[model samples]
Structures are given as structure tokens and as C-alpha cells.
Target: MTRSTTDEAAVPPLPSPKERRRLREAKSLSEKEVAAAVGVTRATVRSWETGRASPRGRKRALYAKLIAPEPAVKPPAVKPSVVKPPAVTPEAGAAAVPEAAAAAVPEAPDLPVAPPVPEAPPAAPPADPPPAPAPAPNSDTRSGAEAPDERRVSPAEAFDELYARTAPGLVRQTYLLTGRRALARESVERAFELAWQRWPEVAVDRDPAGWVRAAAYEYAMSPWHRLRRTHRQPDAPPTEPGKRALFDALLDLPPAYRRTLLLYDGVGLDLPETAAETEASTPAAAGRLMTARAAVAERLPELADAAPAEQSALLHDRIGGLARAEHVPVPRPARAVRTGSENKARLWTRAAVAGVALLIAVTGLTLHTAPTHYEQPISPPERVGGVPPRGGPQKLTAQDLKLQKSLSEQLAHGPERLVPQLE
Candidate 1:
């Protein structure tokens, strides 16, 4: 009996749903039959074949079995004899094949497709709104207003004004204090230099001139100035015959008495002002002034030879000459009193002025002559049982009183006496 051959070429497996549908149609199996064989519902089988779903699990296994290849059947054993065909030439065999069949099949024409338009990226969400602008500064705000610069005057301008107003008086005062024209100039100049440096703070002072005067006095009294004055003493010795005599008498006074006398009398400062300037108490200043006055009294005999008008003229001349030598301008005289029917008023005014002038003159004279009183030898009172005499009535004979009065007058008018002695 002839054996049937089951080794047909295996068909290529379907790759997609469309190929699977074609394969199912070729199989001629109804959707219901395929579903029953694959152990799935008809709808499932239809979906699988229609590409809506894919077979899985038992259904996939069953479908795979249904399409599985049949096993090859063995043929009856045949004798090994074979017949050989004649060899064919390459050209003759190639020519026997149809030209259309030998030529390569053209690939299906590529379908033209428009390039996909790229949708612009969705507009970025708008950025957070910018932070609100800062509020404008108010005109009233402290930071908004311009700061004022502190006003100040130049030192030169200030110094010029000060010098113009004060230089003459200060130089004159300094000459009187030092009794040396050059030294006086130096003192006033130095005081002005110091004032220049402190003008901003000092210009507003109630008495700027007075401040300068005090400063000049302080400078004149300094130890350095004292040393300088001592070094310059020879050069400063009074040259004028009259002044030389006065200076000689003044040199006889003790240093303390001379200083007090000069400051209180020559400088013409009040007792309290003199004390304050000299760093002394009022009582001490008074004592010094009195001592200077007494010293002048003791020297009065020689001084009295000069006439009173001569004495006044000499003093005025010496002071004025010293001031000029020191480069100090003299002050202008005060306005003269007017003469009118108001004679009584003028008389009273004159009297008051005269009284004030007299008081000043007396104070100056007392201070000048105080040194003489201090230097007078005090005779020891007759002791009672060795106890010193208590404060008894000061013994004063007529002659002694007369001598004292004469001495006072001489001291008051003497050209030779520039300073008084201290007791």
C-alpha cells in the first residue's frame, strides 16, 4: 500500500492581528467553533481574530495546538540506486527562466506622508507677577531730607577781627605786667595764636577780649616765662634816668610784694580780680597790697623830691612810650561831657566820675605802698613778765605820724618810686 507524506513545508507564523484574521479565515472555522475549541466565548475568539484582543492562557495554548505542524510519516525502505540528470550550462538554464520572473520585484512605492507638525510647547505658565514696587519716600522722611552742614568761619577772619578789637589793649596790659616792651609783644602775639586755635569755641564767649587778656596773663606768669624774663632781665633794665631810679627802688621790695603790687596797682585790676588772676584769696591779696603800700611809704623820702604833676606826667609818658614800643595802639579819649543848662546834672556826673577815679587811684596807691609797711621793723613792745605784749593801741607819736604822712605824700608823687616796699 502507498504511504501518505505529511512533511509539508511549515507555514510562516502570522505576526499581526490582520495576518491572524486572514489565517483564521483561511482555516474556515466559525467564530463559535474556534471559541469552543479554544475554551473561550465566541466574542473572545472574534475579538482575538479581529485584533481587539489576544489569546492567552488555555485559549492561547489551544489555538497554538490547532495550528501546530503534523508529524512527518516514514516512507517504505527503497534500494540505494539513483539516476543522474545531465549537467546544464549556466547561460542556457538562465535563459530558459522568464525575464520578468528573473528580474527583482520592485518594492512597493513608499507612501508619501506630510511631516508631522510639531505642536508648539504649551505656553509656559505666566511667571509669578513681579513683586510690587516699593512705595515712594515721603518728603517728611528723615532719610529723604538733605542734612545741613555745620557752618564755620575761617581762623584767619576770626583772628583778624579779634586782633583788630583787642590787640592794642592786650599789648598795653602785657607791657605793664612785664615792664618789657619786647616781652609784652611776644606775650600778646602768643595769646592771639592760642585764641586763633580756639576761635570757634571762644569767639562766642561773653568777653573774648577779657579771655585773651587772662590767657596772656597766665602765659606771662608761667614758669617758662619767668625763666625767660630772668634771662632777659639785663636787656629789660629801665634805661630812662627816671625809670631807672624807680626800678632800683622797686627791686628793693620782696618778690611776692613786688608781684602783688604790680598786679594790683600797675595792672589796675580790682583786688578780687587780682586775687583770682594770681590764684590767691582776697585776704592774701589785700595783705600783699598793703605790704606793697608800706614799702612805698618807707621809700617815699627819695620819691617825694619829684613834683606831683611831674610824677603824673612821667607815668603817663612812660606807660604810653612802653605801649608804643610794644606795638600797641593807644585808646582814643572818651567823649567830653557837654556843657548846658543841665549844669547840676553835669556836676553830679563829674563828681561821680571823680569819686570813681579817686577810689581807683587810692586802691592803686595802697597796693603800691603796701610793701613798705610790711618791711617796717616792728619794735618789740615792753614785755610783761616775759609774755609778749598783747595787741595794745598802736603806739604813734606826733613825729611818727608826721613822718608817715610825709612818706605817703612823697610815695604818691615820687618819680623815682615805680613800686612800693612790703612790710
Candidate 2:
């Protein structure tokens, strides 16, 4: 026998997705069991449980029965009670006697006493109609229906989401830090680049936005900015005098104090949080915050009248306004950042390798050219201690030369005499 459409329509409604899951878990049953009982795929059961899809027709009835089964024990029948109008005497009626007074009247002995009416049994409740699903505690009205399933997103997608969500605000904030639109954009972009490079750590961070913000703040507030010619001159001040004064005051304060003030006031961080981010003690952060506030108050005549708390609030608004007023460039796309990070990593790797190779070559050259053995150095010649200074054929040379000349003259004249003597 086939079931009629009416029978299908009479099937009880399914509970909410969360309720379905809860029911299955309460019974110590898994999705597989529900799927097997309902003759559907485990995935379908999961979708039903997650509220991604609702079962229909036969599947719906089967699922409702399996997950939200009727209680085995029937509730005890209850007798119905009816309240009758209090009987009143004509005299009481004319006097507008109260119901309590009429009910209090005792019946006369001669009057026939009416018997109490027996209560009728209540009609049987619809056979095993599952109890109406109780509303989920602390759940929103919309939660009565299945909530949209939360899908697992890839890391790149998650990174892109974080970047898109925070990049614009970060740009504005960095603008506040540096006061230069170009630098602000650059700082935010560079921060994202760094985040992409370390996405594993960044993605797992409790506050990814804070991580990027800190990086951007550090870049924007770097002292090395002073060396950049573009950063030497201040950006065009805000057109409004209030904003201009606020901006100047911020720039005038030291970077640490300005950052502390910004985090505590502008970003709404608590003192301890500000200190943690700034790497300072809470008292130090508080001191910087106070000092910064005082400096700003000194610069702005308007702020001078306000109390410290009011001054901080005013500064926050003004800083926010100042940041928003500047037109910072849109943040670079996550893909672009990831690509840039990869390129940068590759470049650094090559550079490190080249540096190592160059160092090795230099060491090898030094070893090749270095002297192998030690050599003694020659000493300059010196005169003998006992030897008299040699007088070259000097004055004595004149006498000797004269004697030789005389002898030579005698030999030239007496050559024939010497020959004869020799003969």
C-alpha cells in the first residue's frame, strides 16, 4: 500500500540544523547511522545536520523519525475541569452582589441540591506527534532555520581577506604616522609584504590586523625617514587649522610618544596593550601618552580648555579626521604582495649566496699570496773598530808622485847607461 500525500504532509517538521546534530549526538549516533537509517549519503546527512540542505518527502519523514523520534512512553491522560457561573438570587442580582458573596450563600435544606458534574477525559493527542522543537537557548530568531555552513578557506584566501579588510584603514593610520600620502601607502604596502612573507605566523596571530598595523607604524615612524629627501620636508598641512595644528602636534612629538598616544587614543587600545605593542612599561606608555596630550594641548588653543580625558577624545577624533582626510593609495593586492615577497626572498637568497662565494674567494686569494716562510732582513755595513781610516793617495800621494816623476826622468835619460851596465 502506497502512502498518500496527506500522510506525507502529516509528518512532523524537522528540528533546526543545530538541533538535529544535537539530537544525533545525544543518542550516541553518528551521521553515518542517520544516513544508513534514512537511506541517504553521509554527506547528505551532514548537509542536513549543518543546515546546508533540507531533506524532502520520504527522506524528510525518515530523517525526522530517526533524529527526532517520538518518546516511547505516552503521557498520562488529564481530566478537563469547567468553571460554572456562580448562582445568584434575584434579590442579590438587584443589589449587584459580588461573585464571592454569591458563592458564599448556603443552600436551603428544602431545596434540591444539584450533584457536582463529573469532568470528561481530554481527547487523545495526535498519535506520537513529536514534541514541538524547543527553541535553542541564546540563539537568534534567524537560527530557527539552518545557518549557512561555514566553509574552510585556503590560506591565500584568508590572507587576502585579512589584507582587504585592514589595508584601507591601515593606510589611513600610516598616513597619520608619516603625514605623507606616498609614504603612508608605501608603509602599509610594505607591512603587507612582510606579513605575506610570514603568513604562517601572521595567519595564526591573534590579531592579524594589529600585526600589520605595528609593522606599518614601525615603517612609517622609522628614524631613517629623515635621510630620505622626500621626507625631509613636511607634507602639505590639512586645510583646516584645527587639523593642521593636530597634525603638527603629532609630528612634533617623539615617535614613541606619538605611537603610544595613537594606540591608546586613536586605536582604542588599553594602556597595557599600548605598552606591549610599543615595547615599553605601562607607566612609561602612560607618561608618553600624558606628555603627548600635553604637547597637543599646548599646540591647540581649543584642546587647552578641555580636561585630560576630553583632550584625548578630541585628539582621537581630530587624528581620525586628519587620517581620513588624506588620500592614500589603495593597498596592493594579496597576490601581488605574495609575489613580491617570493621575489624578495629569491633575491635575498641569491645575494647571500653571492656574498658567501665572494668571501670564500677572498680567503682563498689571501692564502695563495701569503708568505710561506719568515726571512731575515739585511743590516747596513759599518767600519771595522781597529782599522784606521784609509787616506787615499792624498797629501802623501803628492810626495810619492814627485819621486816617481824624478825616477821616470832619470830612467828616460839613463836608459843607455843602464843598458851598458847590464851588458
Candidate 3:
């Protein structure tokens, strides 16, 4: 294929100052690096990055394309090695260095084939893994027969395959942590959904499945759903009363111990991994695991699954069987956004209702039992211009009223008439 003369002659469009700066910063490139990569001076690069100037012509388009995606990681620092040649004498170096570099480059036709030569060696090792990588390959193998056929999987396909194999196990592990099958199922689904979204990164992980399991466990352990609930009746009772009681006993453990217990015995992670999952030291995890087992044994001695020093596989089997036997229905797969939103809504609603009820209760109590200190205001006794008013006579006397008829004349003239002569 060939470009037309007109197409070749046409100039690429210029990029804006802001666009240039954004791309440069996104790729984490210094002005010097960007300038060198795009074949420009450092001053010009500074002008572009600072929004004082914009890159034009083909270079501007090239710069935009360069920073469109994340920059690739820089190569690891080279290690010191015995095989590396010592520095040569100046005379020998001048003659040999150029000749060696030139000889190292294969012919133009052989250039493409050379890459495959190195790739072929690493590719075959997956089928026949080195002894150092034995444990990993074994765990990844679906079966003895499938181990030979196990090949490199694309990110999407690897994530799907991992989810299918590990989801049930993750659900069971979460059930041990949360004490609810529905919660376990929801947690597992959310974890895998995350794995799917981040498959490109997760696929290259050393233990992608472990990463997802840890995430699921964390999701199940959220306090919102637990706090919003008052008391929940399980969908199905455990086949045995002992098992049910034991499960409740598990809930009583501190979160650290509970998580360590499950990560070690329920999920079958090694002590170091369990510690990592629980954010504890290896010795601390071991201690917690031992203490949890002892606690469980003390709580329910008859439970073989909880017996001290019982194998993890047996615990897994017993718990798995019990979980299934007690399951009434399969819960729908969970969405992270939906679960989080619903939990927050439930918590807020419960809190608001409780607050209103408490306020009403306090008000009613206050109204019913008025304080003795609160009394009616009374006016003091009446005063008569600074003297207290006296009470009137209780009964009336006969002499107090005047007679309607005049007194008899003989009685009236006897004493009083003599006094008038003196006046």
C-alpha cells in the first residue's frame, strides 16, 4: 500500500496548548523527555507544557497519540552479573564494540523470526512448568488430565474461568464470616464483577483468585447490613441445633479473630496469606487461629468442624454440607452499587425513625410527670396603705343599730334636761 502525493503533502492539525499540557502531564513525562520523544527543543517543550505554545504539524498529532493511553512501565534496573564482560582497553574497545553490535543484529528477513525464538522457550514452560513454579501450576490445574492442556488464557477468558472455579468457594468462605448465605452470594458476585472490570490488571496477578476472594470477604464483612438489621431469622435452620448455636458463637468472636479463623480453616489459605488477608503478622495470625479454634471447641465440643487441630479440608466439607443443607433458596447475584446504596438507605431510614420515636417518648414522659418545683404564682395579702387590713366583727350587736321610735318623755327628761340648765 502507498499514500497518494496529496495525502503525503497534507499537514497534520495542531494541538491546543491545554491539550498538549494535559497529555504531557498524564504520561508523567518531563519537558526534556517529551521534547526528545517528539523531536523538539526543551524550550519548545516547556512552552507547550506551560500552555504558552502548542505543538503543530505531524508532531502535535503524534504527541496526543503518545499520551492517549497510560505510559508503559520503565524497565527494571539491570542487575550485576558475573557473565558481563569487564571494560576493554581503549584500543580493543574501539575495534570490538562496533563490530559486536553490528554482528548482533540479524538480517532484515530474520528480524521477525528472532523474537519468536525467545518467546517459544517461555511459552513451553507453562505446559512443562519449572519445579520452582510447581505449586502454582498444580493449584491452577482443574484436574490431572487438564494440567497438560492448560495454556495461556486471555485476560477476559482467564477472569471468567477463575470466577467459575472459585465463586462457590468464595461464597462458602464469606458465609462463614457473615453467617448468611444471601450475603455470601452477594459478596461473591460483587467481587467477580470487579475482577471482570479490572481483568487486564488482575489477569497478570500472581494470585488473581486469591485477590478476588479477599475482596469478597471484605465486602461481606461490612457493618451497614449487620447494623441495620435488628434480629434476622435464617432462611433455613441448620440441620442440627448444635451447628446453629456454633454458627452464632462464631459471630461473637472479634472481627480479627473471626477473619483469621475463616481465612485459615475455611478458605485454606496458608498462615502468611491469612495474615495478609487479615492485616496481621504471621505469628499473630497463628495465635488468633489457635485461639479461635479453642473458643469454638469450648463453645461446642461436639462439633467436629470446630474441634481443636482439625484439618481445614474437613472443616470446609462439613461447613459446606451444612451451608447447602440449611439453604432455603438461592439469592440473586449482587451488584456492588445496589448493595451499598440499599444498605445506606436502610441505615438512614432506621436511624431517622428511631430518633423521631425517641423524641416523642421523651416529650410524653415530660408532660405526664410535671416537676414539683413548678407552682402557680400567688399575690401577697392585701395591705391598707402600709398597714395590714383588719378583719370585721363576726356578729352584729343589738345596740349597734338606732331605735326607730323616740325614747319615752319621762325617762328622757330626768337626767339630760338638768344638764341643759348648766349650759
Output the number of the TM-score-best candidate: 2
Instruction: Give candidate 3's TM-score.
Output: 0.41
Regarding TM-score, does 1 or 3 come out ahead? 3
* 2 against 3, candidate with superior lDDT: 2
Tell me the lDDT of model 2 at 386: 83
For residues 1-423, could you state the per-residue lDDT of candidate 2 as single tens digits?
A: 357867756666776554566566667686678888989998888778655799988888888877775578988876553333344444432334444444543456665543332232232333454587988854665644645664558888988899888889888877777778888888888988899888887876657888789889988888898899988777788888878888888888888988888898898887756766785545678899989888888988888889878887887888788878876788778789888888998999999999999999999999999999998888989867987887775565888989988887774554454444553
Please give the CA lDDT of all the candidate structures.
Answer: 0.57, 0.77, 0.62
TM per candidate? 0.33, 0.56, 0.41
Per-residue lDDT value at 152 in model 1: 55
All candidates: CA RMSD in angstroms?
A: 56.2, 20.0, 20.3
Model 3 is weakest, by summed lDDT over 10 consecutive residues, at 116-125
lDDT of 1: 0.57
TM-score of 2: 0.56
Q: Give residue 66's error in model 1 in angstroms.
A: 99
Clashes of 2: 0
lDDT of model 3 at position 179:
72
lDDT for 346 in candidate 3 is 78
What local lDDT score does residue 348 receive in model 2, on the 0 to 100 scale? Answer: 98
